[model samples]
Target: MFTRCWLWIGRLLRRTLLITLSAGLASGAIGYCYYSLKFSGPVSAEEQIPATEAADSRAIIEDAIRVVEQHRSDTRVLRDAHAKAHGCVKAEVSVLSELPSNLSYGVFSQPGKTWQAWMRLSNGNAYPQFDRARDARGMAIKLLEVEGEKLLGSRSEQDFVMFNHPSFFVRDVAEYRQNFAAQANGQQVLAFLPGWDPRHWEVRHLLIALQTLSPAPETPLASTYNSIAPFKLGPIASKYRVIPSPENCPSYTPPAQNRDLPNFLRNALYQQLSIDRVDACFALQVQLQDPTHFMPIEDPSVEWDEALAPFVTVAKIRVAAQDFDSREQNLFCDNLAFNPWQALPEHRPLGGINRLRKEVYEAVNVYRHQRNQQSQTP
Candidate 1:
């Protein structure tokens, strides 16, 4: 009887050991999968370029900067005008689940499973425009309540992203300064600046002219925008994009003469809400190649190769329908600041142009706000 009991006890102990070993193996596999997806996925090829080519590119950027300084003066005028025209009232604010379907490339870092955000939609231009024109659309988003060490500065959770088109008139900081100079000084000075390429100037002029023509009369709130900056994500970098989804309303282009763009956009948003809730999902795309791979860091004229790393959708943004015409919503949307420098350590802006943005954008914001306040007092 004693011998039989010992054998049964030994068998039960063996079964327990086998079960424990299986559970440990399973847990190890699960942990490895999680780490691989989060860290190993975004690694990219190293970027390299020739020295002579880089020097030439630098010269071109220097010339562009000179041209911009000669032309652009008093950069704060337009921003102040925008603030005043829109009034000082704060707009009603709310958190969104996802971005609209039409605006595809919006990404925001969430803290504690919640994203704090503020957005403003406006007609894009320097100032003084034909109200009936097909103006460029502006969408500025500030993702607040973020938790992370900022890329360059001391501020935490301060990131601003502004977008117009896939490609920008100038690619780096020196060129952007030159472009601003041209705008400030008007077209006459820009015509004489050495190395002032007409083709390049034309692109910038054309964008401004288009903005002058495009007016958001019908659906002022419905238009979408993008961030043209090339940003780094861990070892990989990409340009951020945003689009408006057409889940509810079929996608349709407006007529040439869109006189009621603002109202049309407002009505469409309202209609979607009245029936079923509307949702906007912004897709995040990363560019695979580094800056040194295709073009020099200074020159904005050369286009980067898009085939290597195509855009991938990573996150979704949703906004529920509500009355946007209220005074509260206007104030929050219009006055809230958006800066690209507000970013996580993984995603930082690259190249000289991005560096200059840190100074120029902040200065512009401060100057404009000050001017607006001064103008309002009796």
Candidate 2:
């Protein structure tokens, strides 16, 4: 079954590779082909909805939340599908002050203050896959002892979750159902749904927009991570990023087909940790709310050009040398929740995708705790 799964995934990836090649020469016909598949009509400036109307995401949020609930495991040990965190290590974040402004939000508002954080790196697939295979990786950072009014009740931690890619596949909650459907079938051991295109270019541009720079990463420490969605920085809106900057230990590529171990990535992380302390720095960039050219806050699909508004360094994150690949720490990391909403009110997650995450994450958090037979909050 594992061999068959690998072959099946290989076939699907070959198709994506072809798409990637064709993407290099983006033509008018290709654009028309994508436009033809739009459920919400042609993509246009007029099609972009306001931040408020786009916030009417309750129905999709509830429906998708129910789907995840139905997929719950009966054991106290299983993890939430997608971003199955395999490693959690001790880390710290130093919040460097940005230019003084009334607009600076949340953790950024009080610059120069340091906060202890836990860094959890995970594979994007719900079910484990070979590290050699192409897949999304996750970097979730939880800034502890944060002092601010909370977005959901009184939570002292500010969580900034990011993916290796800067853009997400789906644009809104309504499209999340389709994305979930693909995932539900793709993870099955036996077969995938017919025409299962997780990178449905016609449906969304993320297939091209958000593909990882590396098909497979040597370690989580090697890749830069992006929040993908916008957040309120005090009164201003911005996105979060983490760039890897370890001296001497550069990111590398693993063998194209090394399927001997299911925990290859974890092993790689442990190997890196054993060598020396890991270092990564975080950046906060303001989003320009251009209602005409770029809908900064709402449509995250509109990739913000770094040349226009470069991300400024707001914090430096360091992961000290430690053993991270242990059953105890892995389980603890699994139990630990890192929701964007688990943040300061000043840094409340902004935009439609973020708005949906507020409810979806809460639902998943409750579901995971119940399945694990443990009630813990972060």
Q: After superposition, how far is residue 153 of candidate 2 from its true place, in Å?
A: 1.1
Write the residue-wise lDDT of candidate 2 on 244-337 in tens digits: 6544234444333244677677776676565444433334334433333343565676566665556676666777667777777777787898
Residue 171 C-alpha lDDT in model 1: 45
Taking all chains together, the TM-score of candidate 1 against the true structure is 0.58
Count of backbone clashes, every candidate in sequence? 73, 3
Which candidate leads the pack in TM-score? 2
Global CA lDDT of candidate 1, please?
Answer: 0.47
Question: Per-model C-alpha lDDT, please?
Answer: 0.47, 0.65
List where candidate 2 sits over 4 angstroms from the true fold: 1-26, 29-74, 77-81, 102-104, 182-206, 209-214, 247-260, 275-293
Task: Give candidate 2's error at residue 343 in angstroms.
Answer: 0.9
lDDT string for model 1 (9-120, tens) is: 9999999999999999997887678535633323233333334434444554444344333333355334422222222111222223453333222233322134555555
